[model samples]
Target: MKTDPERFILENTSVLSPPHVPEIRLHLASEVHDLWLKTEEDLEEIGLPPPFWAFAWAGGQGLARYILDHPETVEGKRVLDFASGSGLVAIAAAKAGAVEVLAADIDPWARTAVRLNAALNDADLAFTDDDLIGRSVDFDVVLAGDVFYDSDFARALVEWFVNLAESGCLVLVGDPGRSYRPTAHLDPLATYEVPVTRALEDSEVKKTTVWKFRQ
Candidate 1:
């Protein structure tokens, strides 16, 4: 099939908006425990309006930025970035020298974005679709970001993390303290004041926290 013009434009562009220029120079990794890829222009072309409209969560972006600054966390480890939005976390893991990285998301657009961004950054990532649901894989670390906005989804995701952790995978999550964050199973690891443009359906400027699975 012929590629869509918007997708084509996003694939070829470097910078998307003026504010995004800084992010363009910075690499992003998945905060979710799956495969994710990121591109600067994915949000606009996907029809998401500003802020959340850009690709990925500021929390995820922040975490990726952090990992880039501190590569020891992922170097030589096998990693997974689940619910990989713009695949920022996955990209970060790859850049940080993870031996293997996978970015996973339910959204098809997200998967495409991950592939494009990985190519843009010259990073290698494994991408998976819903076919991997209910399946488990061995990974040293798993990351997630901004995934607790909805109660039901948060609960389910947390449960999955708990299972992963029990299986010996280290799990990490970056949350903006959304209403649905599961307080019981998570322990705060670090906190960040992420600068954000309004991209989500609600609110702007999210202050996020990074947490590790406790149980």
Candidate 2:
């Protein structure tokens, strides 16, 4: 069955709430799309804490904005959007002229969202929910956005990314100053002041940084 992207967003919108609900508007190439994220009141209705989908992080938004600004980074490159949520980064890569873009996530809902968003933008993306453990693929670049919230997961992901970088694949991480960000073997590439709603607990606005893994 085909996934309804708008319905998925609507159903998951109440999972977590931010302090202020902002209508996020982003352009996929010449096409523009908008979605209203949940506010704190919405979380109360769903009975869940913040970071419900890890979709509200500023890092993803920053990465999407970066792709829109610098199309050359993805042009002609084979890209992978790791832990893709809402598929924003994957869509941006595809719109920016990536030869091949894959959106990989453990959550089935996230993969569904990727397919839906790709269709909405009139782009094609490879979606997968395969376990990445001990799996390796050669690609020009791997893009990760806001995947450092949890310590265990962050450690595992960083180790995996570092291994990929060592094998000559460029890995970029878009982080919102998460505590679990690895300090070593990482080089800061760019920083952006992302306008973020307080979706996570006690966070107001996040000034995210984009770092490249140094081999």
Candidate 3:
């Protein structure tokens, strides 16, 4: 903990809404925020984490949209938002009527960001900085967004998700076609043209899809 996460996030982000999921608000790094421009080296020098929690990613936006639209997916069930940056998807689960929501991420900064964003939306949720990729949990629904960027990480997550799905927990993911996303054991549920900043994505709008993990 080199940086004071709460202070750093407050100074570097603005309260804003992800375009596709405008019903929920978050503390995000906008174009005017230097966080949107800082390179990894710059962030390291400033004692900041990668700051994934500072932006609303396209995959998160699409997943949040789907959850908000299809309340039955989470309503009255315990939900887990894995790799939850900024707690956007977790908040959506709460808003959609989940009885309990847990946002899990390994980044310490993300914990603070999730706290702030959840408070902004008055969405009650819990957060854990533990890496839950290989562990079993007590949630009824599992939602992940934009996690399949690297081959090794993707492989680990896919395996864990498959196990969770087979155990009868509803597993869902929002992906923007990352290179290593699973090619099997998944069923597409919904898709959206998620609006995003070019700084974070290849294009201003990403064609994102929500998929359900199946046995």
Q: Which one is best on TM-score? A: 3
Computed on alpha carbons, the lDDT of every model, listed in order, comes to 0.66, 0.68, 0.88
lDDT tens digits by residue: candidate 1, 1-215: 24553464364444432121243332232121111123224333434322222355766866676666667888999998887766777888898899999998776455666776677677888987664434687889888877787777777787788888888888888887778888799888767666664534255566677788975
TM-score, one value per model: 0.76, 0.77, 0.93
Q: What would the TM-score be for candidate 2 when compared with the true structure?
A: 0.77
**Local accuracy of candidate 3 as per-residue lDDT tens digits, 93-123:** 9999999999999875789899999999999
Ranking by lDDT: 3, 2, 1
Compute the lDDT of residue 55 as modeled in candidate 1.
Answer: 52
Q: Tens digits of per-residue lDDT for model 2 on 1-215? A: 23354464555444332222122322111111112224234323443333223354577777776776778888999999988876778877888899999888876356655665667577778988887745698689899888888899888987888899999988888888888989686898778777565434355567778888988
Model 1 TM: 0.76
Q: Candidate 3, 189: how far from true, in Å?
A: 0.5
Better of 1 and 3 by lDDT: 3
How should the candidates be ordered by TM-score, best one leading? 3, 2, 1
Q: Judging by TM-score, tell me the better candidate of 1 and 2.
A: 2
